[model samples]
Target: MNSPVVSKNAEGAYSVKAPLRGIRKSCKYIFSNIYLYVDKNPVYQPLQLWSDEQVLQHQAFEKEQGFELTEFKNFEDIKEMSCDFKEYGICEVTDGSLPDMTYHVSTKEHTLTFDVKEK
Candidate 1:
């Protein structure tokens, strides 16, 4: 899996290019939420969950419209930051009776700390 690229444009808005090809293979997990840590503190926000089908459809749309970039136009003066993609779904081995499980596809190490650059 490729690490998500995070950068700040001239306007001070942040953008992230998170590749979903690896997560697409399973077709089981859905995008739950994004974890953003600024200056080592978790930034809380209400992020909606994207269903599995929705994710697949979005991926296809991105393929046609060029690279998919999720932009954050509300943050500035960030000294340090990191991000992680969280997903939730049922296990493949389950017999449709198990509970949903959550997993993290980190961009960096276990801490999900990635290098942020200014443009």
Candidate 2:
């Protein structure tokens, strides 16, 4: 396990800030591969259960970025899964064209965020 970069504010609120360093090839890697720890339960994969259209859009975006998006062949596969984020708390995603980016997560106890940068 890796130690996450975390800190507390003057208000006693906690936050986790991780630096993501690498060139992620697809949307799956960007959304699913990254590790998200909530209350130390375990590393969470946010994009494991995405909508069919969401997956298609991701593939299109990846295609535009010169990546061979070859994961799901149809919408049925994507729609079959349900994305339930209740366990992770409130979440917000600032979709970026590039894989290297940042994330800001806000929970009742703390705010978690990560920065993904080019390696």
Most TM-score-accurate candidate: 1
lDDT of each: 0.38, 0.37
Look at candidate 2 and tell me the lDDT of residue 51: 35
Predicted candidate 1 versus true structure: per-residue lDDT over 1-119, tens digit per residue: 54568888897666676553345566634333444433312322222323344545566787788976333211221223223223322122122222122223422312222333221
List the candidates' TM-scores in order: 0.27, 0.25
lDDT of 2 by residue, 19-52 (tens): 3222345432222223443332232334322334
Off by over 4 Å in 1: 22-43, 46-119
lDDT of 2: 0.37
